[model samples]
Target: MTVSSSTECVIVKYEGRIATVMLNRPAVLNALDEATLKELLYKLKEVAGSAVDVVVLCGNGRGFSAGGDIKSMLSSSDESKFLPIMNTISELVVTLYTMPKLVISAIHGPTAGLGLSLALAADYVIADTSSVIAMNFIGIALIPDGGGHFFLQNRVGTTAAKQIIWEGKRMTADEALKAGVVDEVVAQDFPKAVREKAEAWLQKPIKAMVQTKQILCEGNKQSLLQVLELEKEGQFRMRATADHKEGIAAFLEKRIPVFQGK
Candidate 1:
């Protein structure tokens, strides 16, 4: 079932109507690098065109994803790489949001920033109780990217989304469920429950499910236009701050971020 990638950044498995795309970097807590992001986009694009009735996104080991690869990104001498990489990450989430098939994220551990955006873009999000989900961009003096602002606002509305993203608060799976960020919180029976849900979804007519997905996405599409514009402006402003640089550095140093709120 494993579909090998050219870059070996992502692994895909197909069984019946479901295609499981695994983020394959367990060594670094599945932290996303540029290549991983590109491979994920490519894999999702490929799946969208296939006969796959549903897609399940998950990570291999401890975490869903630790967001971006701070070590790799910060170690690079070039700052010019940031915008393009962030844009591609944004496109990946947008792709997930607009995909025709039913998409679900099975998040077990930490899902932060772009990772949380990816989950929120899905039709349903299934998280384990031990998981931590957060927007987390403000901690780095950056605004939400990877369509985080757009997807989060769609789920939790403007006020809650503002508090979550602006405050960069880490939410428990139960809290995320209450906030509508997670559709289900499965503590002990996650694997079985997720499988049952996916199997149940596959029982219905694929076209009907697809159309329903389209209708839901269409309802939210108009809102993304404004959300994305505001998010881009926020990122532009955040990148200019000294705290942003310090935040990234602090993350790499494994120390607490000291943001002056500048």
Candidate 2:
């Protein structure tokens, strides 16, 4: 696949069997605005049902992602406006979680808030010595969304996941590895190391990987129809929140959000 750039913030590059999804906004530390999310979603859909053997998700500039674009959120805070943005985020996370292909995240630098959910959805998460992972939702007076509440609890147990979100503590790469959130901690030249690992995964039959992923994901599955209803209910509830307004507003203003949790 010949990878092309829809814009500077996103680039899709394919070499041999590995498709690389790079977050290109290094200047802003790859902070994800609405456009970035849209581009990413479009790119992901582009690769859907393709013959790509493996997918590598990484950031271009300083880190993987600094989380959602605060400026973008704060500027669009009416519940009506905010709900769609949140919907987009929710869909992205769910898509990544259930993706048929092997998704690997090469995380370096800061991955915060919604970005953390993105990292957690990947099949394998590899971080460098300098990487940082944080929930940081409480820092802005918001509860964890974007499936962080569900994914983190599943990975690290409910009690610990609650503590992490409540405290909004940012974990270093080593700390994340110790907590089992990340699969491996590499040395300084971590990107290359992660690429090597991704390349290796590409050599195997994708069906085997997909089957293993299905089993792991299925272990906790409820009736499929029930789960879909649950997700719809969540969307309905979040749409009624005052904090959603604040979150979107503060993001657009590039200022700290004052979430009243109404």
Candidate 3:
């Protein structure tokens, strides 16, 4: 049996015990705007409440999500517009991290910034060989958000996480795996690999696995919330910096940014 609950920006499809949630905006590499984020949050909650043992989060088009929408960033010049968006992101990240079901992020193509953060929240991440992963918020003179600080530190330790964030370099799938950013790298038939992995997990004592996840996640949930709060305040301050202005200008102009460190 197949069940689908889809919207303009997010698609939810359930097949037996597996639910697949796909980011649907292909035009801009699925760059998440406020609307898309809200839709995704709704669908995630719906799936969390369902009977699915495994949830596969993926993208519909050529790649997984690129990150937050650049257009939205350009437009949200004030606190009123920006805070709401950040809050939504925080809620969505928390929900995904605390979800009872085993979550897998199947990543392909460019996954950077907030997109990478979201993928890190998953229980396991499977990336295609050609996929590029980055925590490139520094390029925009912005700190990582969406519990990125917590998740990255959890995956790769604090020192390495700080280095990666400061350098803002993109990593190939193998490099990401080496850096402890992703779980598995698929060389061929990426979709088949993800399906087989999911099927294999389904054959296990999934309820016990989920229970263990719940215990650990619940214990650490408060820490993630605290990081999210710090990110919100820090990002707001960064948005007001002169470096941020120059960074956005350089990005739009397709030139190298000269950050003033302001």
Better of 1 and 3 by TM-score: 3
lDDT of 2 by residue, 128-189 (tens): 88898998876655666667777777778889888988888989999988887788999767
Clashing residue pair totals per candidate (backbone < 3 A): 0, 13, 0
Please write out the lDDT profile of model 1 over residues 200-224, one tens digit for every residue: 9888887887897888778877676
lDDT for each candidate structure: 0.82, 0.76, 0.91
Worst 10 residues of 3 by lDDT: 1-10
Which candidate has the highest TM-score of all? 3
Query: Which residue pairs does candidate 3 place in steric collision?
Result: none
Order the candidate numbers by TM-score, best to worst: 3, 1, 2
TM of each candidate vs. truth: 0.90, 0.83, 0.96
> What is the Cα-based TM-score of model 2?
0.83
RMSD versus native structure for model 3: 2.6
RMSD of 1: 2.7
RMSD of each: 2.7, 4.1, 2.6
Q: Which ten residues in a row are the worst by lDDT in model 2?
A: 220-229
CA displacement after TM-score superposition, residue 110 of candidate 1 (Å): 0.8
Q: Which stretches of model 1 miss by more than 4 angstroms? A: 1-7
